[model samples]
Target: MSLLDFDADQLAAFAAEVRQDYDVLKDKDLKLDLTRGKPAAEQLDLADALLELPGKGNHHAADGTDVRNYGNLAGLADVRGIWAELLGVELEQIYAGDSSSLNIMFDLVSWAYAFGTNDSERPWKDEETVKWICPVPGYDRHFTITEKFGFEMISVPMLEDGPDLNAIQELVKDPQVKGMWVVPVFSNPTGVTTSEEIARGLAEMETAAPDFRIVWDNAYAVHTLTDEFPPVHDVLGFAEAAGNPNRFWYLTSTSKITHAGAGVSFFASSVDNLDWYKSVASVRGIGPNKVNQLAHARYFGDADGVREVMRKHADILAPKFTKVLEILEERLGQYEVARWTEPKGGYFISLDVIDGTASRVVELAKEAGIALTGAGSSFPLKQDPNNRNIRLAPSLPPVAEVTAAMDGVATCVLLAAVEKLGA
Candidate 1:
């Protein structure tokens, strides 16, 4: 019988039984972790060619600039050309940078607080307070960056299409709202793509803060599980045509496409915005690691090479995701005590447990020898108001282990729901 269909007394009894079973299970002490979203060792091995890239001797860029020496603060032109094709942007509009796209984001935020973007004259720090709109069931790392800088984060509810446009529109009317972080394609945890209509709407929104920008971090742009996944509409172009030339700042990386620590990252925006960014970034460093850029240029010969490599990733990730989905369906589908996303692409499946029970279920799973990303991690400041969301990363585990882990997770959900319902 489904846990949701149970009467109060039946649920209570079930909870008691689960508690007793958990105690016994804990004694065996098996160890398994499904916490971080790191790629498996096998996945990392797929990019072995990148290790010997740029060959043993060639270390100069297409423009005759020595990669080992420092000069081009924006990055090598050939590297920018590579990302231009990948990001569907013009070569002049793309900037290839260091390993961390997160570093570029931090710089943008710092600039907004210190010097301001093209449209606004005053620095954000000049104000008494600054606010940012964060779509809930979002990426924890995204929220961490904003919160660390002391921005008042307002939670915007997420729907299957994307973040609620009504909420975002309403919130942006406040001058205090400076920016919003978006993962438009295969969003973190939820795996929902932002709709074209909402993307356009976001670009056209009438904002009180003239310097407001959309932090478009498309981290999983090429990481799809299926061949039929939808195309990502270009928000940068949409915004420009809608009369806001500098409305969006898009960032992406080859972290999953190649080596995580060694991959190159890309940033794209309008020409005006690029000029402003270069003026500030020039003071930061001489330039990004050119040798790494040269290596990626060699490894990905052209745009098509990137597509060929991504297809390989899909082959490996598809089975793991399928196994987790099947296990969840077999064990928990009938319960109605939880609902989960059936994503076509992306790194995670977001599961919503009964209200007030997500944390308890995660705790229960841990006792039975499983580790999960802490409950509430999908929300700002790690707070899910309803306490019902849990992000499950199934990509790192092998198919057999993914099956076993989902089975354990389903049991914990039912047991926790029963306890919360006082059955």
Candidate 2:
């Protein structure tokens, strides 16, 4: 029988049994973390080339600019060219920004609030209350950024294809709705891809605020586990075709691909947006770390080189992801109390338990020494009204440990679901 229709009482009993087993199996009082979606030590080994600078002997860019000296506010042309190839945009349209994409995102918000985009008339901060559409079961960090800036975040529903376009169209009609955050490829925690139809709809959408943009953070663009990965629809091209050239602010980084804290990030947009961003970024700093950009350019010479690197990551990650899925199937699949996403190429597996039981399940897991991303973190303002979504990051731990942790999580889920039903 499917987990959705299993007997709650039977599931409860199994949970108790599993908890007993876990208690006995684990002897040491070791503190293990599965809260953050960080790369494991083995995964970090894949970026060893980045440790040494590529052109220490030679320091000039293709445009005759010194790589060591910092003056290219828009970043080195070759680095931008490489990132553009990876992001599927024109070379002139890409901006090789600093190490953090988050910083770039922050700057975009600042610019929109203060000066507004070229297409829009009024600044967002001048409005009574600015708002943003945050698809539910999304990246927590995205929501955090919006919340920090005091934007009223409206939670839009997310499906396998992407954010509900019907809701998005309706929300954008309100002048307060400025933007939406999307992780189109193997989205965080859910590991689902947005459909082409939704991509087209978003590109073609009409908003009361002309400055309405989609913050497309493709952090896992190249991190796929399977051979048949979903292709990212060319949203920028679609938007331009639909006469909405300024509708997207695409951001990506080699953080997960290389080093988390020290990787170069890229921003892609229309020529208009690029010019606006460059003018604003000039005031912020001279330029991002060219040495790091050179390192990335050397490591992944082109789009094909990045793909080759991702294949290595898949080798390490695929087995771990499969192990977690298998353990979850063996333990909770029989119970029918929850359902989960079987992602082909992302760092997360999203599990949905019976409504209102997520917090209890997470609490139980914590008591048993297994930590998880908070229950409501997937939603805006840390509020999941149904309290049903749970993000499982299985990549950080070793295979054996991941298996054990998943088993522990299953026990907690079953226990919580059964108790909720009993009450």
Best by TM-score: 1
Q: Write the per-residue lDDT of candidate 2 for residues 117-197, one digit (tens) a residue.
A: 877678777889989999889999999988988999998888878889999999999987889999998998788888889
State each model's CA lDDT, in order: 0.86, 0.83
* Clash number by candidate, in order: 2, 1
Top model number, lDDT = 1
Model 1, position 320: C-alpha lDDT score: 85
Runs in model 1 with CA error above 4 Å?
A: 8-28
* lDDT tens digits, residue span 1-423, model 1: 788678778777778877676666566575777887778778888889878878777987888888998778778898789778767788888888988898889899989789887777688888888999999899999999899889999999888999899999999999989899998888989999999999999998889888899999989887878765457677878888888889899998888888887888888999999899999998877789989998988888887777777778889998988888887788678877888888888899899989999999899989889999999998999999999999999878887788777877877887787777765
lDDT of 1 at 304: 72
What RMSD value applies to candidate 2?
2.1
- Residue pairs in clash, model 1: 11-423, 12-423
TM-score of each: 0.96, 0.94
Off by over 4 Å in 2: 1-30
